[model samples]
Target: MSELMKIQENLRETARKLLANGEASLVIGYALGSEVSRVVPAFISREDEVDRLVWNPLCINNLAKYLLDYRHEPGKVAVVVKGCDSRAIIRLLQDNQITREKVIILGIPCPGLINPDLVAARLDPGAQITVAAVSKQDFSLQTGEGTFTFTRDEALLKKCRDCEQHTPVIADFMLGEEIPPNDPGDPFVAVKTLEELPVEERSAYWDKQFSRCLRCYACRNVCPACTCRECVFDQAEPCWVAKANNLPENTAFHLIRAFHVAGRCVDCGECERVCPVNIPLSLLNRKILKDMKDLFNVPTPGTSLEELPPLGAFTKSDPDEFM
Candidate 1:
């Protein structure tokens, strides 16, 4: 069998053992959602539920976010994670949110995930994905008319396409082939391009995009890092920013949101993933990440628990100069 099949078998076997022996209360993995959606996340509570789990293109809804929600629960939980998901786990561990001891990590070596929206935009929206194949550089889907192909670069999640860390930084029960080293390509080109534009033109560009924001806060709500018990924006008495759809408030909301995740944003790109209006939220995040990298040689919040994030941990000689 191919590596993918072998990995799937191993995942199923491991998940079954955990659920059967009551080692885990639930095993979070990908399962079929319905006719339209390719693969949705499944919570496998019983050994019998093992058959339901399957991995595929649209298994992109992050499972790391589930750890925060599940950490409060009683027993251990088993969750599948790709390279990116594991990085989020590292961030979680760094923040002391979830103890590494409480959960089992089933790390999958990801080739890449497909963007159904991107595919559908090119083909008929109603066209069904009969069979989808993937390789390091290509993604092909069989439609009713003819099989269509696109480069993996074109089909991948904007954040994932440029992901340097393709291996889970941490995992107990890792499956699949060894991950290759991260490519040395800058994924923050959009952010840099925006920075290159004249201040007036840049303002106008963002003014148009931010103006379209409906103050829905979908981006904030879905963010793994924004998991505060009582968010400042939700608070009525000293509202951090006004809860209006005006450009100023909307822009502030986004800016503040991005700033909150500054050094810590794993560039998971989920913020951009679920936006109703396609705002390249990751661009904001990538800019902050780049700045943090420049300011402090630290690229990410250290995966270890003792280190405090930049928001709380202030250094004496921090640069405040504006070049």
Candidate 2:
């Protein structure tokens, strides 16, 4: 069996024990979706349902957001998390969205995941994937029709290109062997490229990207940092943003959201992943993240629970730009 299969089996067994032994009342993982190229979040509450949990390259959804759904429930909830998703877990804990003791984290050292759109384009319609394997350099997929392979460079998700964290920083129970961290060489290459552009050119670039937005709010809804009880965009009385799907409204929404999550975004890349119009939401968030790191010398939020967010903390040494 490939290493992933072994991990999948271990995950199932762990979930089974958690539910059967009353350690957790719910287990959240991934299951086969209606389409072979898709994987949906699975919620297992019974020992018999643990078999529904599966792990594969296609399991890309950030499962941490679902913890908000169960925050008020009485029993502990178990969640499977990749390194990036684990950051979301920390985001919630830091924000007090969920208590740390209320959840069990099953961390998986991700090898990386394939971009679903790219994989879907290559797959035969309705093709069923039977096996998947990953190496340091490439991914191999065994489908019902035949086997296919792609170099990690060609098929890996953009977020994985400079992945600095392969092992979860925090986990109550780690499900797989520790994977070596990617070098993440010059992690800000894309951001730097944009930064080098002329002011007019950079403004034009974002204007074009934001113009294509449909105002669907999928980016906001999927974002783990967006936990406001009443989002500004959704307010009807003040109407912070008009509902019209025009460039001005769309740009306002995106800019506001990017600022709102600034210093708090874990850079999980889920907002970009779920966008139907394919907006590069990660770029916007990363731009702010880069600025934060450069200006405040603060480490990325969610990397550690003890590190306070720059916006959330006040220190005597904080830069005094006003003076």
Candidate 3:
């Protein structure tokens, strides 16, 4: 059996046992999407429904944020998490959005994931994938038509290319064998490139990117760090930012949000993934992350709960720029 199938089987059996024994009230996983190349979030509460659970390169979403939906529920909410998603789980725990006792984490060590759009383009959308396997080098899918193999360069998601963590940092149960971490060369390379540009060029570049904003707020909604009960952008009484979709308003929204999540952003790249206009939000957020590192020597946010966010903590050695 392929590694993907083994992991999928383990995930299904574990979820079944968790539900059948009343250990968990819910199991959040991935199910085959409408297209063979895509996967959607599956919330399974019954043992029989565990068969619907799947593990493949297409299971790309960070499922940790959904824990917020069940935080106040009766029993523990079990969730499947990859390395990146596990960071989100930690973020939620640190923020007190969900207590660790109320959550059951099932972790999967992922080498990488395929880009759905690229996979969809290679195969017929209606094709049913009978088998799939993911490796450090390539992704292979067995369909009714035939077997298709895509090199990592051809199919891997951009976010997964520089993945620093291959295994979840924390898990109640590990569903697969741990994969070694990849060397993420210069996580701040892009940020440094932008910094070297002239101030006028930098402003013009962002102005162009922000000008395409639809004000859909999809980035904010999908962000795990944005856990505020009522976001400032949505407040009409105070009207911090107008409802208009112009460049000024849009720039304000993005800039304000960047600052808000400055030290808290986990670098999950969901904002850039969900944006309709293809905004380089990861770049923007990483710029702040790079600054935080340079100024206070901090690692990526959500990587650990033991350390406090730079802005959330203070010390005698901290730089006081204003003074």
Candidate 4:
């Protein structure tokens, strides 16, 4: 069997046992989307429904935030998490958004995921994916048409290509074999490249990107760091930001958000993934991440629950130039 199918089978068995044994009332996972190349979040409450769960390179949604919907609900919630999604779980835990007792973490060691858009571009949209496999070097799909393969460079999601964690940092139950994390070179290389640009060029680049903002707030909605019940952008009493779509308002919104998640962003790349205009939101977040690292000598957010976010904690030795 292909590696993807093997993982899917294991996931189904695990979820089935959780539901059947009353260990969990719900299992949040990925299900086959309308298109074979796409996958959508699945909530399984019955043992039979566990079969709906699947694992593959295209299973990209961060399932961690869905736990909030059930945090107040009765029974334990079992959530499937990739390495990136696992970080969001830690974020929620550290924020006290959800209790560990109510959560059952099903962790998956992701090699990387294939870009579904790239897969759709190459295959028939309606094609049924009979089998799928992924590795460090390439991803392959089997369909009635035949076997199709793409080199990692050509098809891997950029976020996956730059990912630092393959095995989840925490798991109540690990669903797949441990996959060692790949060395993605310097994580700050792109940030450094952007920093080296002229001041005028840097400003112009961001202005051009932010100018196309629809303010749909997909980035904010999908962001795991955006756990606020009533976000500042939506408040009318304080009227912190107007509802306008102009470049100035949009730039203000983006800057305000970048700072809001300054030390807490796990660099999951969901903000960039969900942005319709293709704004490099991850790059913007990473710039702050780099600065936080340089100034605070801190590790990536959500990697550990023991370490507090740099901005959230105060220390005597913290840089004080701003004061």
Tens-digit per-residue lDDT, 1-323, candidate 4 = 86668878888999999999999999999998999789999999998788788888888999898898999989999999999889999999988999999999999999899888888888888887878898667899888899899899888898887888888988999888888877888988889999999999999999999999999999998888999999999999899999988999999999999999999999899989888889999899999999999999998999988888888888899999999
Better of 1 and 2 by lDDT: 2
Candidate 3 minimal-lDDT segment of 10 residues: 299-308
Q: Which ten contiguous residues of candidate 1 have the minimum total lDDT?
A: 299-308
Q: Supply every candidate's count of residue pairs whose N, Cα or C atoms clash at under 3 angstroms.
A: 0, 0, 0, 0
Model 3 misplaced stretches (Cα beyond 4 Å): none
Per-residue lDDT tens digits for candidate 1, residues 269-309, read 78888889988787778888878777776655534345566
Error of 3 at 214 (Å): 0.6
Clashes of 2: 0
Between candidates 1 and 4, the TM-score winner: 4
TM-scores for all predictions: 0.88, 0.96, 0.97, 0.97
TM match of model 2 to true structure:
0.96
Q: The CA-based lDDT of model 1 is what?
A: 0.76
Tell me the deviation in Å of residue 117 in model 2.
3.0
